[model samples]
Target: MADEVGTYEATVTVTDDEGRTDTDTLYVHVEARDLPEALLSGPGTAIAGESRIYTLFGNAGDALLSSALWTLNGEYQESEDLGGQSSVSLKEKITFEKPGEYRLNGTLADEAGFQAQDSMNITVWSPTAHLLVTLTDTNSPVNESEVLEVDATVENLGQAKSDQPVWLTREGNVVDVIPGMELRPGETADVTLEWQTDPGDAGTHDIGVHSLNDTDSGEAVVTPGGGGDVFFAVGYTSPPPSTVAPGETVQPTVEVTNTGTATGTQTVVMLDIHGTPVESTEMTLSPGESRKVTTFSWTPTVSDLGTGDLVVQSEDDEASAEVTVQGSTHFDVEFASVVPTNTSKITPPGPHDWINVTVNVTNTGDTPGKQDIRLTRTVWPPKPTLPREQKDEVQNVTLDPGESTEVELLWWSPRTSDLQSCDGETKCYLIYTQLGIHSEDDEEYKMPYDRGGGGGGGNPPCTGPNPPPDSWCGTPVTLFSASEIEAGDSVGVSVKIYNHYASTEWRGVNIKSHHVSSYGPGSYKNWQAKLEADDSAQPGQKIKVCVTMESWAGSHLRSNYDPKAKAPAARKGSFGCSTIPVVDGGDDGGGGGGR
Candidate 1:
């Protein structure tokens, strides 16, 4: 970096392992080097979880670069500390976890601390999972009730593992997203998605799954009747109501587009979940033409309460959107998926085990309401006279219209007596959760094969205990923690911690955010980690928080372990978390995502 330019004499010598020596003529050329400048090259459009290599060449890869710093801004903020003075190359691969517009900036600094900066604006897409979708059914001219299976081989080609949902698409539309695919780097998984054919359609139907990235080119012919040169794709133009009173009129507009190469006239009909036609309208459209038709005022009665779908069918294609109908009562509860928190087993649930179950419920009524949702457990296909049903839990649910909430319940695994009435040959014994006049979801558990031997952590809780067993004695793990930490003007942060295990006593807990506020700078022993974000943090910038728990003379803490896997289960009378967390219990141990 010096201004002085000079060439000095240089010498070169070589020596063999033996006592032998050789010399060659050497020349030296020296000149004043230019200041380092940041040069960055990468794709402007990137897939969210797909890693792409980017290069930062300082002065066209000739400068004596001391360091190269990479920073992401705009939709999100990220700083990559890359490239030291002795770095062999400036090429680095980066994977954006979320879809957003980000300015990727690169800075190169010289030994004198002189630096230059360059950047590129990149837009990330959310289709991070690459899937090769193909049909598993070989039946031709299939029957209406015949099930068509879609095999989507989804692969996580990225460098990181994620629990992001893997959505199944049909005709370039998302029909379902299988949650918890949980793929690791270079991992491949086979997800079987079902596409049930419409009930009374005898026509050549074109059905296919979406590959998300527009790479899935496979399609399967569902039924064969008419060789239609003219086809129509149908969908809804206007959305349905969040909640509709009983006997009230609902008219959602349906749109049909001509995707075939010929001009065609087709009747678009509104149907129910059972493919029962409720109303119909006919229209003619040229190729690539779209026309809208409203459903003739369909009214729902009290019997048609709870939730249903607004299904529209035109020709061989159909699309549907969820529609909810509220009864005379002000509240209607819709049950969603159930996630197990603080649990050791998910598949083939063990008996007599203590586990926390998180139930997602949404209020789809017009007005705010509070009511209790009861979860019951009985042998599947319960016979009233036999009467072996067990009333498990009754948790109060309160929410405004269209609002969803999670309720955590402690499920004591069913003992041998619980499964006595059900026949093992039928194999329908399972857990059930329901509310009055609303639908419910179920979870199944199995009786441990070897109960006396007490294997696989399936044995019942210890009745007589002193210094209990290993995991029972003290297997300390994070039960819950904040999802995010938010700090701003007048920022008052509060974090809560609750222990699920009675024996595993937490000596201390702490929450630390990115910026120093009223709280201390770093993590300290405290019950809560009430921290704030930096004042300079802009939109999409993440405020990171650290939640930790110290166990006094116990097993080492497990961080961010999935409840679906073998780890720890919650004890009775213990609720909430961040007594040790990384799990989002019913109550979030900390704040959530970037705010």
Candidate 2:
């Protein structure tokens, strides 16, 4: 009873004499029963190297679930099993790796020992461009001036969409180009090209294709005497193997034959991508004679993992064969070095200062790989860290063995309050960087900028400015000397200035006024001066002004102080005016300017 579930009573009676001697009643319990069902739900398709989550739904109808187990790719996944529980339902998640078809199986057991199994197919695909080349008729004989057809078939084997053009070439020259076309996963497109044989094109020709990251080629033969006479033919004795692992040795043989009534010589060669001969041998054959020559045995390196052509050729005869070199995948990334060093040092870094840390990563393995990089700055003395963590990602990073790339992580200096604790310490901050590939770590670095704090007692106390004592200043002028002038002594002050305006000339320039701010009016008297512009006073021109003074009261002249100077009315733009600071022995410094 699908819809009814309850206890029911049935009565049975048996009478021997008098038709009503005895009666028996039986009570029965009727309930619904269901088998445990296992259902899998997830995306059916995924790309290679992409992670996808798949869930298994286990349900035990009208019964408490005892256990739920999951299997991926026929392998039992103990970790993906839901422990035995009295709950009616259970769920488990699984992740798939690589491309191809995978089976996800789930088994659900109920408390009654009833079990059910279900499975789903997950198709994992990797977006790869595969190209194939075919001649309409490889064995057909064609005379000079004949037209031949070639086809290039391209397929997308990945889960992503792709649109790539296919180029057709004849004997290393591009003869036709097909416009790019979009192809969904598992889609294929055929591009056909026609080429006419020239008078000199009297032998086998290579018709090939160049497509997205892949190449394929085929051969077409042209006989000198079409359909009437046999001619020279050159071809590989046997086609090269479709694939060979990297570093595996391979020896391919080529056959050169004189099918006509003459003897001929041909060269069998194995060339690299650059047309440089890697292996070659000579073959001479008589009429109707074919000879197979083994050029050389070579091992394909990591750089040789691709499609290449092997050609056997004579003056008017040639044959081409395609060989593919395959290599196993490897994942390896290492830190090469940090640009500008892993350590950066700056004097008294300001709040607005920023330092860029560049980490170099190289593909040290035979295959391409990707990695993550991070940079962190740790402030010392128990201060809050600045820019606690910065992360960068690199995806689909393909590089040949030994190739390298660089990624930059930036660190901005923290506020003064954050680093104030390190003022008296030798090193203020520590920089730690990590390249998240194989758990590699770069050397720890330190930033030692000036921090304000404790000073040795022996040093004199600073009493001049708010910036503190022994402070350094930058200016356009450099003071050489400064000394106090006695009451009876005469002192001379010479000032020099630079004309900074590069584009315009200043006319009627004058040394309008001059004064030493540290000295009061009573300290000097009878100030007379002569000023003159340089003869060629052009932009960036320098001028000199000399002043003589008689002291009325002793005064101090600071060697490194700014002196005031004025320009004539004719000058345009504010002159970069500065004071020459008094230096040792009362010598004054010179000033510079630019408009």
Candidate 3:
């Protein structure tokens, strides 16, 4: 039955040596009953010089005296008042000077003068796993290149595993971890780690080994000898392009500085990821000097394309940066070197018949790639004839790496009415220059600065393309004429040759072509040529002139071209009798310029 939990005063009566009814009374402080309990705990085995903790747990049966008595091997050691507590724990720290077995006990007392006791036996012995470090070599003086070896032996003699690894320490700083020190009960392992001698390692160093449970130490003496005195620190690298083709030569720039006291000479090597040297450059630098090396360049073969590294190495130090080598298809393009070459792009207006724009594209990669160049025209401040038109023309060019070529595209020119509308407004053709796939740059083919009310800077208003040379103009009735005049055939007439080009900036291309598309290229296909060839007196009006075409009468073509005619062969004229196919002076157009 469970005892009631409360404090109570009780009387105990006893009579001794009294024949009559005489009683001696004593008062008892009664506390609730509890089972006498005790627990004594300590390590069953411990190393002799190591302090270990022993704990005692006990329950005062009735909470009376609440005192505990401790003993070792039945010898009275000490008494601890349990503070009259029913249940309490007491702890003591014990250290054994000698290894042996010892018995420990905890006795508890209750209010009824009853005693209950708990006893435990602990076995104290030397540690199971004893670790020792030995510096076998008496390397009295070690050279910088000399390697010193330290051996550590660890044996786990207990029934449990030991996890503390044996480590070598220099001035208390752990310098190396002896591999495979984890001992499996009764298993022993030995490990060794090295300390390489250096020029700065000339003085004495305290080297020892250690573990958690038990430790034994030893030392090594190293006297300095000749070794590395120079150290190099790598700073930065200007790596070659990540991608390249076979036989592509690439340059890698590496910066290295000598941080040692001595003048250091070392080689910076460019190597494949596999550590194979691809190229090397050697430099000699004073202490604290940095040198950027670019003398070494590598030519990669098809077989050499892969990831690589650029390494700066000296006798005692090394540093590296990662680089890559592979074949690549890189796409890039620019508009006149991009952004009007840095400003908004603007070009002179093209021929009246059609707008022709040329772009120069270069493949700058090391591998062939495709470039799709598109020219688009979108008229702003839209006009009726222009009709907010968007015409897209794309030309695909496959260029070998390092190859460059010129490409040309054409668009329908703005009609006379469309140009008239742009006279007073910010209305101009917004020509978008598209290179590659998504990149776009733009240039403007703006309206003429002088948009005279008379049309085309005062030249006759051209509703449609003027008659192309070599065709109808040769005889007047026909619109387009024969490609060339027959031999011994000569003819001349008076008519209007309207060359109402807006500005002089429009060169290298015919500007006055209208109503039709004419591609005479280098041919003197404009009216200016006709007036130049004539020997007769010139007309006073800038646009009107007389042209006598005695087309090298005997030779059919202008076999005997008159240099005195002063026609520019490069920009203005072509194979023709005298000047360009002569234009017949007109009566209605007067001396004013005609188109």
- Model 1: lDDT of residue 329: 23
Error of 2 at 244 (Å): 20
lDDT of 3 by residue, 462-571 (tens): 24566322221221212122212222223222323333333211222222221222323222234332122224434331222223221111121112332233211211
Question: Candidate 2 residues 280-310, lDDT tens each?
Answer: 5545566788777675566778778788765
Question: Worst lDDT window (10 residues) for model 1?
Answer: 567-576
TM-score of 2: 0.29
- Candidate 3 Cα misplacement greater than 4 A, ranges: 1-308, 322-367, 377-389, 395-399, 402-472, 475-595
Score candidate 3 by lDDT: 0.49
> Order the candidates by TM-score, highest first — what do you get?
2, 3, 1
Weakest 10 consecutive residues of candidate 2 by summed lDDT: 551-560
Q: What's the lDDT for candidate 2? A: 0.48
Q: Who wins the lDDT comparison?
A: 1
Candidates 1 and 3 compared: the better one by lDDT is: 1
Models sorted by lDDT, best on top: 1, 3, 2
Which candidate wins on TM-score?
2
